[model samples]
Target: MPMPHILGADHVVVTVRDLDASAAAWAKLGFTVSPRGTHSPHLGTGNYTIMFQDDYLELLGVLTPTDQNKPTQDFLAAREGIERTAFTTDSAAGGAAELKKRGLEPLGPVHFGRPVDLPGGGTGEAKFNVFRWPLLENPGGMRIFACEHLSRHTVWIPELMVHANGAKAIARIEILTADPKAAAEHMSRLIDEPAIADGAVWKVPSGGRRADFVFLDAAAFAARYPDAVRAGATTSGAAALVLVTDDLAKAKAIPGAVTTGSAVSIPASAANGVVVSFVAR
Candidate 1:
């Protein structure tokens, strides 16, 4: 069973050095990027979202130095890529309570909001309550958090859902690790989910239509994403994001995209250190 109050994948956060540059890069890949939204002053961050049917992607950048954004600043100093992934939660407070019951310490059920530009006119606040599974509790080299979106409609606007690449959803997240089994088990325990052994790879289903987290060793990751994998790349953390696209041709048409078998992949060098692959629906 899944963790209490935790729904499947909500969105993936890609920490970037330049918000505008990252947003433009994603737009070049055929995604319809949303207008940049600045978070509360205390958070000292901003983001541009790529909305999907159910899940989405956030390209985040540090706007100013703040104690709250230290982790993000540290990540940016090293490299820019997938910083964390958020799970949808019915209630942030309930999620934290469940985590405590599981013998895990949960961070704050903090409330924050960002002003969003409405489609037609005016502005709206995208409110959210969130709790983290500890800053250092990075399972599978990726940080995990639960988010309760109080103003969903302000964020997932219908107009922003359409993409030129025909991307519909995040199908899978690939994590490269020295030991896939251990990484998978760690993630499974954190989420109260089962880890399925798939030959040399391990899979943790996020439930429902949400993307599954696939953990594999370096060799396996290189074999699966030959064109996307960089030489001597970090052996762990989020390596790739696979999206289900309605039109494979459009994905293949992206500049610097490589087609291998059924999927078209963009190397990490071009995608802010995250390999992006598109497979037909």
Candidate 2:
């Protein structure tokens, strides 16, 4: 049997304590963020999304601490940062079965929807079927999942894709872990891309999604992203984002950008505790 298709990253979730504040911060960083959207009352969460062409970034926060929001709330309580990285899938059910065949039992093909405020002040719905496979279940770290976009029209708005900072695409996700080999192996299975050894670091090449994953050990991670480590992300999880920019000068001019060699790193302090690096194209 053929392996189920695993599309590249759909969106990354930055779990924050306050949705409005986080959205404002992202706007300051030059992203065109969407208006706040609330989940169904039962989920007790709200979010602001920065929509890109193929992928996006989500600022998710608990609205009311119910059973559904407890895990996310606890994550924020410990540390506020990139909480989960979600891959895109055409079929959540098939993905779950493929995962099971590969020796990882997925949690759900969980069905959920949120109300989206359309551009013209109309209301629409964005539905999803999610399958979560926990490689690391601890708080203040990254969780891996797959999201099947039921209504693509409702989520990907063309107007929201334009950013002032020349950010064209999400290039890579930097994950810091104690064991680079193990984390890279797990990410390989999760994203269905074989890991390539790059000396001490391991990288998953940007498949069709045009985004990759980089795995680094704690010491190397701290050396590269000391603020991310200081922000309570000492354990295994998604640490930072590498955004591809069209103009290096434009990206460098963004407030709080720290030029480190050729790349400009926006420390976690300004980015809801997630380090954002801008690489000139």
Candidate 3:
């Protein structure tokens, strides 16, 4: 049987308590964040986005105290950091079916659309179909979902592509877990790709040409970037994102950027509670 296509990282969701504050924090680090937008009334959430060439980063927060907002609220209550890693697919329904075949029951091709502010002073609809599984746990955790874009205009704004930090793409997503082997197996099943064991870490190819997912147990995670853990990131879940920038020196000049070897890390306090590492490629 042919393997299912997993199109790397579509975007990572950072659940924050305040979308405005979080957007400000990211902007301070040189990212061009989109204006805030709300989800459908049923979803009860609002977000600001940082658009990249192919993928993006979403800063999400609860908008209203409705049932739909419960998940965002809960995620924030638990830890306000990287909460999800969404993969892109050509078809979300097909992705859900393939996941079922692998013994993971995916929820839906949930259809939804949001109003986007157009550059020319009007609004447009950006639609999506998302498939998710409800049973996955996140102790050193991350949510895996597949997204199908119905309208490309909602994202990929040329104006939002320019960042002062020279960040162009995501290099890697690091998740810290209690058990690397189990996490690797779970990710392998999700993306239909074999996990490559790397000493104390497991590498899962995101099918994202420029990115990969790296899972490390607590000890290894701390040993590799102790400062991240020390900054109050949850010891067992989606940890830090490594972004590729063309000018390391310019990126290093961003406030709160600390250089560790060839990479510069922006601590959680300055990032609205997420750790972002910048690597000049």
Candidate 4:
């Protein structure tokens, strides 16, 4: 059988210039980020740095000063900004195998494990069994990486480094891309999901749980959504968003929150655009 469309967004990776600062700020907001780690010789190049979560946010940057030096300056050159969205799928075996049949190459079923300490001082560890697979044919364009969380500890949101709120819901993602229509058709056919478009916006939900991406013209969308703000999104090419909250008053009380507008939002639109709305835990 064909592989599943998405198991959920699994985790989002952002390339940042300052790991400590970003991790600290997000932690203050409740996300649990792991200590910084250098790239493994196994991952090729051995020049990457990362932070983790079962369902986590990867803060990638150069590993050391030498890696940050000259010819390699681009890697650390102030993060003029780079962001990529990742989709976690149901079957790594089936997905990778199937993608290979379609002429795509997947990296591995490699695993990543790390120790984690909680805000209350309790400590534990987690493991990640992952495989990097191909989605779009373009080498550096878009891809799918399978991830499994092996944290026997805390109640963290497996896919995100963000705290587990036990929120029973996930929002859809709409990607604004160069060829929304084609992307929609390809993804719909590949994942067996119904795809539609209103111009160049391709929309699809992470096969399992919940998460979606719609690719469209960035400028046009900001205008259409009107009250959107891209606060804590991946620098990745794909657009990330959070919608207006239903209770601005309530959301404000939450720490680390930065309100954008006046009107409140429904739970449905929590991650709809580029913002943070009061969502149910």
Top lDDT: which candidate number? 1
What digit string (tens of lDDT, one per residue) describes model 3 on residues 104-215? 6787878877889988789998888998766453424787777898888778889998899988988888888878878887777656677889898998887848478888
Q: Which predicted model would earn the best TM-score? A: 1
- The C-alpha lDDT values of all candidates are 0.90, 0.80, 0.80, 0.46
Ranking by lDDT: 1, 3, 2, 4
Report lDDT (Cα) of residue 272, candidate 2.
75
Give me the runs in candidate 4 sitting further than 4 Å from their true place.
1-6, 27-58, 64-82, 89-91, 118-123, 135-141, 152-170, 198-200, 225-236, 243-248, 253-281
| Candidate 1 lDDT over residue span 4-35, tens digit each | 79899999999999999989989998999999
TM-score of 1: 0.97
Cα-based RMSD of candidate 1: 1.3
What is the Å distance of residue 32 in model 4 from its true position?
Answer: 6.0
Instruction: Candidate 2: list runs displaced more than 4 Å.
Output: 1-3, 135-141, 222-236
**Of candidates 4 and 2, the better by TM-score:** 2
Q: TM-scores across all candidates?
A: 0.97, 0.90, 0.93, 0.64
lDDT of 2 by residue, 96-138 (tens): 9988887777888888899888887789999999888854532
Clashes of 1: 0
The better candidate by TM-score, 1 or 2, is 1
Ranking by TM-score: 1, 3, 2, 4
Deviation from native of the Cα of residue 191 in model 3, angstroms: 1.5
* Model 1 spans with C-alpha error above 4 angstroms: 227-234
